[model samples]
Every structure is written in C-alpha cells, then in structure tokens.
Target: MTMYSTDTPVNGQDQEVPPFGTAPIPGSRGEEKRAHLQARRTEDRADRREAAEERRRDREHKRRMKTEAKNAKVGLALQKKAERQKLRAKRRKERAGRLVELREKLSHHMPLWGLPVVLVSLAVGASGQADAALAAGMGWASGGVPILTEGMTLTLAGLTAQAIEQRRPHGWLMRATWATATGAAAINAAGHYIAGVEDGADKALYRAVLYAGASMLGLVLWWIVMRSKRAAISGRSAEETTRWKRLARRHPVLVRRARRVVDNTGLSLPEAYAMVWQRANGAAPGEPSIREIRASRRAAFKRTQAEAWDGRTRFSRTAPAPAVVVPAAVEPEPETVPELASEAAPELIPAPYLPVALAVPGLDGQWIAHRVPVHPLPAWRPCQEPGSETATTRFPQGQEPLPDPSPDASEDEDGTQPDEAQEQVREQVADDRLDKARALVEQAALEGRNLRRHPSNRQMARHLGCRPGTAREYLTQVLAERGIRR
Candidate 1:
C-alpha cells in the first residue's frame, strides 16, 4: 500500500514530490509477476514430462526386442524337439522293417525245420513197431544220434545263460515241442488208420481223427515239458519240470546225453567225419547256429591255407579248349602288313617256386622277385624281447641275445672286428656313466634342493641319462635324507 502527499518532502526539497514508494514488483505490480513465475515453472515441468515420455518409449522398444529374442529361442527349441521326434520315428520304422524281413526269412526256413520234426516223429513211432526202419533213419539223420555235438551244446548253453541273466522269453523250445507233438499225432493217426479192422471204414476214420488229435496233444505235452523245465531253472512257474542233468542221471547211462546240435558242415564225403563228432553232445531248440560259426571258422581256416600256399598253391583253374582247324595264311604287301616279331622273345620260364612260370614275369622286365614270408607278430601278444623262450622247437638255440646296436659305422674298423668290441666298451661306459650322473644329483640334492621347487626338473634329468620323473624321484630321496622341506 503506497500513499503520496503533496506537502511531503522526499529526497530533498518537497516540491510536492511523489510519495517515496518502493518500485512495484516487475510484472506482479498487479499479479503478472506471479503469473510469469508460474508460467516458467509450468514450461519446465512440461519439458521434463516430455523427456520422461521419450525415455519410457526407449525402454519399451528395448523390452519388445528382448521379448522377440526370447520367443525366437523358444521356437528354435520346439523345432529341434520336433526334428528329434521325427528321427526317432524313422528309426523305429527301420527297425520294424528289419524285423519283418527276418521273420520272412524264418518262414522260408520253416520247411527245412519241418523235415527234422517229421522224421523224428516217424522214428519215434517206428521204435515200437518198425525198429529196423527207425534205426536206419536215425543213423542216417543223426549219424546214430545227435549232431554238432560239443560246439552246438556250448553255444546253446551260452544262449540259455544269457537269456536267464537278461530275463526274457524264448519261443524256440516252445515252437519245437509244438511241431514235434503235431507231427507225432499225425503219424500215429495215419498208422492206425492204415491198419484197418473189420469195422474198417469207421475204425479208419476214428483212428485218423484220434491220431491227429493225439499228435497235436503230444506236441502240447512236449511244450509243457520244456517250458516247465525252463521255468524251474529260471525260478519261474509253469509246471513241475526236472533238469536235464537229473533226468540223465536217472536214465540209463548209455541213453543219457546233452541235447545241443549246431552244424554247418558242407555236404561232402569228408564232412562225414564231422558228423561223427556231432552225436556225442547236446540238443538245442532248432537248427543250430553252426552255419554262422562255421563260416567264421572257414575264413580263418582259409587264411591258414593261404599262408601255407605261398607261390606253390594259388592257381586259377582253366578249362581245356576244344581243337580247331587252321588254314594256311597268304602273304600281304610290305607297306600294309604288320608282323609280330616274336623271334627275339624268349619263352616264359617259371621260377623254381612258381606254380606257373612266365618269361615276362611281372609288369616290367622279368625282375628277380623273391617271395619272402613275413610272419606277422601275433596280434594278441606283445613283442617278445630278448632272452624270452620261443614257442617253436627248432628255433635258434639258447636265449636269443639282445641286439647290440653300434652308434653308426662310426667305428674305425682298422681291418679288425671293431663293431663287436666297441659295443662291449659302450656297455661298460654306460655302467660307469650312471655313477657319474649320480654324483652330480647327489651334490645338488645335498643342498636341500628340489628341481620341482626350482625352475625345471627336466634340467636335472638331462644331467642324468634317465627320465625327468626318475630324476624327481632321486632328488626327492635325497631331500628325504637331508630332512628338509624343500
């Protein structure tokens, strides 16, 4: 609130000077100043809000990129999982196909299997009536009885053992028993039907039906026996079954036997010898795995044969040629004619070791080729060093001495046997050298020193002719003697 008086003197002479008044606040003389301040603050706040908004937009953009990256990672994982599933499905399909193929092979082989079952059933029936025929057939098929004796027995035993350990079902014995029973019943029924009675037709029909059923039942019984036995041994349950060993013990010694037969012998006269060995062993469920084992053994046998062959055995069998008529040749003009000048060529002469000799022995000149048999070291064994016993009886006598290698032809031969004598001297020198090496390390070690604690153990080993590990050991021993921590 300001008042001005005409009579008031201000600053000096009154002169009706305007009342002395404080200068009005710049725009706020009425309220404009306060408004200006408020405007300024408002503008500042607006600028800050815009800056914060910009920052928030930047953060949102960064967040979206992070989210997109996460989504991509998840999608890639899913795609990989799908690919893995596809691969597994493909594998499953391949395995299924292979199993089917194996099954098909088995079906074709079933005929071969059927022969034995039928033959066996007939033999069993004949044993009661046609003994001679039974014996003959048995002798022919089994070479008396059983085939592929020991090997087949062993393989089957191994399979059974593995089956027991792995805990699995085996269809082999079951299927075999079933077939045998069916075969036996059919044979019995046929035999009865053939031996017709007074009520011939009705009796024949009845006998045939009964025999077939009996044969089928026989097969079922066989399976029951086998399965029960397996279950007993495997500690499972089917029906009470006895072990083969116990049965063998209870039966006549002559009839007692193992029941395994695997055979892969070829149908040759010589294979008869092999068949003889087959009867003394055991029996398996079906055709023995003899063929596979034989194939493997045959290859090994061939390798041995080839080794024995050298140049003396390997040969190509050629067929004899039929005779042909020859016609006389007419001479041609010198310019157009070509002649084989074999006049200077020598007839092919075979080497003394060669099965067939040739003049142009090899690809080039008739080179003096020598066939040196290098017996390779056995793969299963390590190299036998000097002083070891050789397996062969006719090897070089006494222990073979270690090979004495000289430094080089570095010896001054002097027309004397320098190499041998020098080798002896080197051996002697080496013996003394170790002693000198010991002296150096011994001194270092006395100083309570360890190469390991210092710069290098290799340096110490270099001073010794042995290895770094050895040097460290020696140094450690020395430290132990000195009773030092180093």
Candidate 2:
C-alpha cells in the first residue's frame, strides 16, 4: 500500500507509445499500398476542384466581353440603320412627282413644233385644188377668157376638149362645140340676171350650163376609154398565143393538143375564137364572128384558172415532179388592136410599156408578179429529256428551257472550287445564331407556362436577343411562317 512510483525518467520529452493496433490501424506491406492510393486520390480531388474554379472564372469573363461587344455594335448599327430609314421615307414622298414626270415624257407622240405645221399644209393644198377647178369653170363660161395669163389660160383650156386635141376646132369637134355653146349661153343668162336678186334664175341657169360642159368632156373621154380597153384586150390575146407557143415547146403534155388545134383548123383568129367558145359552153355558134371567139377565149381562160387553181385543188402539184407535156398554145398571129374610144389615151399607148414615160403619176411597176419558190413552214419539235423518253412539260412553269451553260462557266483548268468563302461564313454565322435563339425560345416558352401566356414583351425580347419592335416583327413573321391566321 505504501506508494512506490515504478515509472522511470527518459529523455526530456513526452515519450508515450500507442497501444497495439489502435493508433492508425498500423501499416504493413499491403496496408502501405492502400495508404499510397488513398493519399493520391485526395491530392487529385483538390487539383480537380481548383481547375473547375479557374474554368468558371474564364467563362464569366468571356461572356461579359461578348455582351459588351454586342452592345457596342447595336449602337453603331442602329444609328446607321436610322439614317437609311430616314432617307427612304423622304424619297417616298417625292416618288409620285417623279412617276408623273416619267409618264409624261413617255406619252407625247409628236414634237411640240411639228404637228401644227403638217395640219396647216394639208388644209392649204386641199383649198388650192378646189379654187383652181372653180376658176377654170368660170373662164370656160366667159367665152374662153382671152385676157387670162398664159398659164391660167392653159389650165382653163386643158379643162375643155378644145385644148386637149391640140386646140383644133375639129375632130371630136362636136363635143367641144357643144361645150362652147352651152357655156356661152350660161354667161349670157347670168348677165341678164344682174338687175336684182329676184329669183337668181340666171345664176341657176349658168350653173346648169357649166355642169353641161364638164359632162360633155366626160362623155367623150368615157367613149375613147371604152374603145382603148377593147383594143388592149384584143392585142393581149394575140400576145398570149405567141407566149403559149414558146412555153408549150418546153413541156410535152400541152404540145400535142395545141398542134392538133393549129394544124387541123388553120387556126385563124376567128376560127380560134369559135373553138375557144365551144370549149367554154360545150358548143359553138354556127359561123361565129372574130368578136365572139375573143369573148369566148377570155371566158375559157378564166374558167380554166378557176378549175385549176381554186379550191378544186388542181393548183397544188399532185406529183412530186410536175408532169412534162406538150403545150396547147397556138402560134403567133397578127392581130390588130382596135382604136380607143377616147382619143387622148392613144397618144401615150405606144409608149405604155415604158413605165417611166407612160406611168400614171403614182404608179410603179414593182407590183408585177415574179416567179419564186415558197418553202413551207418547219414542223415543231417538242423538247424531250434524255433517257426519260418523255416530252418535258417545258412550259409548265413560266420558264424557258435552260440553254447549255455558257462556255465561260466551264470548270477551271486547276479544278479549284469557285470561291464562295464569304457566303459560307455568313451561312455558318446564321446557323449558330439560329441555334442559340431556338434554345432561348424553348426556355422562355417553358417559363411562360409556369408564369402567364403574355409575358413582358421586353423580357421575351431579351430572351430573343432582339429589340422590342424587332421582336414584334419577328413574332409576326414567325406566325406567318407557320401559316397561322390571326
């Protein structure tokens, strides 16, 4: 029981030994392996946490910088955009006046100075012709007006038969005498009517006589014209016979019939006329005169053309090559042209073929028929796609078939792709923006369901990353794009 301390003093330190296995669960060869692995794991986890914190800080900085850059761009872009809009508005106000000026410039057909002058010249010429006719009439009634100027007297004389026949008082003398007598009486009657304006009977009588003078001239000219026409027709028939003989020799089919008609009948003009008449009516009059034959020949010629060229279908060539046949034309014959009833036309008759000398003032000879080949129009070839073997509905849309690509568009010698680098960049940027906007819209839409249908538009705009008005426009555009009705 007496205290006797059994502890012994060691070095100057608190030296205490742990119990057998309670210390740190003592390490062995295998236990040391586990210790190293646990220590490594603790170190790795600390490094990962620091790395994650650095990445988050970096992302925050980048986001702030991007926001600032986009805000800066918005101000610069909006100012320029406002200037453009203002210019467009101002121009819109002036557009109506510009359109009016353009329309007026395109519409007026004539120059300011030209139209009135043409109208005036036409009026003056018409009046001058009428006045000349009236003055000529007055001169004729006043005993030929010997006091007239040379040109005026000539003009007046030309209006009557006296000057037309070389101013002779004979040969068609009856017509001129009649005109002179009637015209003179009219002048005498007018002289008697000068007392007062009683009934103006003398004026009326003078007018009638003046008309009679014109009528007498017209009648003589008409008779001469009829005679000339008959003579010309007779002469033409004779010419045709000679032409037919030449043409007949070149082709065999008509030659046989023509030779028989010529040799068997002697083919005098009168006999030819009779034969031609018989062909027309299927019978000839007994001992027909030369005139009857001429009439019949013309009728038959016209009838033949009707049967040959009209809808009877003979006009068209039946065989690919026209059949060669002898001509039926008669040999050339001496046929006299009867004199014209109107004597004046005969003066120019001999020179009629010389168009420059004999042509009426406005006539030209170019209208004469000439032989030429006429080709038929080409057949239409429908467009067909290769291999498909079906004609394309080429005009289904309002587009012409694409012609072959131009030579300039051929591939380059180097085989390099065409440079669309800028377009690629724009498209890539658009894709990125659209993806981000879609993500934002989806998030906003989910939040709206938890809140209300019509959220703050500005809040929605912020989610869209666009201005309020732009967001409104986009909303409208999207609804339309979705084909939604209001």
Candidate 3:
C-alpha cells in the first residue's frame, strides 16, 4: 500500500522524510531531537515534583516547630504554677507549725487548762442546789437563782481575766468577782443547811460546810490560776521582784512617791523608782548641780571683769602723755571791745561733787572700789572775743583736753564711711550665718534628722544659739536652696 511522506521542518531545521506507519531511524536528527525534548520534559517534571515535596516538607516542619514551642510555653506556665502552689503550701505548713508550737506552749500551763473543769463542776453543783432551794420557796419563778448567783460570779471572773490579759486595771472587777463568789458560797451553804435541817443539826452543819467548801474551792482554784496568769504575763524576774520588795520595805515613802509618779506619768515601776531616787538624792556624782553651775558662771564673770580691769590698767600705764599746747603771745589789736555788764559777770558755780564708784587695781590684782568726784557738768567759762590770746582757751588747769579727730581718718581707701563699713560687716555676718545654716542642714541630713519638724528646729536653735523661729527660717532657706520641699 502506498504511504504518505512525513517530512517536516522542526524548529527551522530540515529533517528526513519517513513513511507513515514506520518508525524513524535510530540516531536520526528527528529522533535525537524528540528524545532530547522528552528527557528535558521529564527532568522538569521531576524537578517540579521535588520542589512541591520540599515545600510540603517545609510547611510541616514549621507547623511542628510552632506546636513544640506552644507545648513548651504551656509546660513552663504549669511549672511556674506548681512552684507558686508549692510556695503557698510551704507557708501554710510553716503557719500550722507555729500554731502547733504556740498551742503546746499554752498547754504547758496546767492550771490554765484544769481550772475551768473544776470551776464548771463546782458551779453546776452549787447552781443546782441553789435553784432547788429557791424553787422550794419561790417555785419555778426562782429558776433564775442559779443564773444570778453562779452566772454573775463566772461573768465577773471572766471579765477580770480579760482585763488582766489586756493589761488593764481591773481592781473593781476583781473585787466584784470575789464578792459574788462569797455570796454564792453563802447561798449554797444556806440552801444545804435548810435542806438538811430535818435530818439532824450535826448533819445539817456538815452538809452546809461541805456545800460551802465546794462553792469556795472553785474560786480558790480560779484565784490561783489568775495569779499564775498575771505573774506569767508580767514577765518580771524574781530578782527584780525581790529588789522592789526590798526597796518598798526600806523606803516606803520613796516607793509611794514612785507609785504616784507612775500613775501620773504612765511610766513603768523601775523607771519611776529611778526618777524618784534620783530626785531624792539630788544630782548624781560627777554631774554639776544648779548651784555649782551658778557659781561657775559667777566666777567666769569675775574673771572676765578682772581681765578687763587689768587690760585697762596696762593701757593707762603704757599710753603716751598728751602734748600740752602753749598759746603763742600775739599782740592784741587796738580795737574797741565790749565790756561785760555787772549782771553778765561770769559766776564760777562749783561743780557738783557726785560720788562715783571707781574700780582701782590693787597690789594683788584685785579690784577695790573708791568713791571720787565725777561731776556731770563742767565749770562755767566767760565768753572770749575772736582771735584773743587767752591761757584758758589753749589749756585748762588740772585737765587735759582731748585732741580733735581728723575727718579723713575714719574713711577707708574706697571712701566707705563707718556706716557703710558697718553695713558691709553686717552683710558678711549674714552670709556667714547662711553658710553655717547650710552646714548644719547637711549634718542633720547625715544624721537622719529633718529640721522641718518643730522638735528638730528647737534642737537646731540650741546648736546655733538662735531662736527657734530664726532657726526655722534658716532651715527653710537652706531646704529651698537645695530644691527640697517642706
């Protein structure tokens, strides 16, 4: 059969014609091209499949890592929760142990635990008997007898105990408790006596005594317990108690004074006693008394005065004598001079002799006082003409006049006068005071004290030798400069 020719140009290359239904020759260009194309396609397909598998693997790995991280976080949270729970459990266990220890300590006091049982039994028996006795006379309406007698006693005793525990004064409550207990004992005895009166006198007496003893026994036991509790709570040593007792016996007056002090000041017995003893004994050894301090201040004042007197004496002895200025003889001009009238004649009024105490230095460096004339006003002088040469104008008899002071002597190089210099000195003093205040503030801060408080301000005033208000002002300025608030 005749077959069609399969000749075509593949990729712009000439290829040999092959008959239909026949395979191309091996190693031919067409065959090689097709083979190469198929191989490349397969390789590309394999590469795509490998890439897709790698992507899937990467996604799975990321998901696994995220899940592991989540699990680790949850585990850490659980661990922290467990640690917290464990810590809480440890605290609770420690608290329980402390409570157990406290309970054991409290249980060691046997009277504290046994007294209640004995008291309860006695109260129950006494109350029953009292109730029956009261009912015999007042019927069921007297059922409250037990409550009034036993209940009241127990209530007062409990209140006394509470007061003692709280460290409050309960003398009245204690007295009331004792009084109620006595009344209950008496009631119990009377009830028993009346009930046994039909039996015999002796038996009635015995019964009364027995019942009264029962009623009183509980109170005695309770009293012992209360005393024990009080002694334990007081925490006073036996030596201290003995010392206090000895002090009371030896010096009852002082003890009484101490007691009053304690009541007034709320101080403890030892502190009050010490205060009383110190006051009674005056100042302690090595400490100066008020009289001694006053004597010392007087001695210091005397020494200061003596030193000043000595300095003045030395200055007077060593100072140069004043120069006497003799007036030059000037010829008077022939001019008409007005003569004084008879009424205007100069009258020499004798200077009043005023007695003044003069401190004279003695040979032994002691001051001796002498009365001398030191008048306030000088002798009257007649008026003289201008340019007159008179001996009285130049020199006075038995008196040396003070020389005139030059105006320029008191001025500084900068022409600052005494007033301005004094002002500058005052400013410098203020600046020094400010510096001292700042130093004091720093010292107070180092010592952990705040000068803003009133007490601290008083202390600062004492240290600075100033008033508290002035010290407060200084502290305010210092704190303000440091940017500190009040």
Per-residue CA lDDT of model 1 for 282-368, tens digit only, reads 312222234433444455556666786535323646544546879679788568565665878956655223222212122111233
Looking at model 3, report the run of 10 residues with the lowest lDDT sum: 388-397
Q: Where does candidate 3 stray beyond 4 Å?
A: 1-121, 124-136, 249-257, 275-486
Model 3 backbone overlap count:
0
Q: Give one digit per residue, the lDDT tens place, for model 2 in 1-486.
A: 573222322453222333455665555896566557656766888899989999998899899999999998998899899999998888986897788776553223223343354234323322333334344566443433322222232233334332233322223444544454344334333333332225677665564444334333433443354344334544556666555455456434434444445544566444554455455435443433345434544555555557775343446655355558999999999999976577654553331121122111111112322122122334335675444233432221233443333325655476533333323444554454445444544565676542223334454465555566655554544444435433
Off by over 4 Å in 1: 1-39, 42-48, 51-77, 80-84, 104-108, 111-183, 186-486
* Total backbone collisions for each predicted model: 14, 17, 0
Superposed Cα RMSD, model 3: 29.4
TM-score of 2: 0.15
Q: How would you encode candidate 3's per-residue C-alpha lDDT over 296-333 as one tens digit per residue?
A: 44555555567755333543757455578999999998
- Which runs in model 2 stand beyond 4 Å of their true positions? 1-198, 201-206, 209-226, 229-234, 238-486
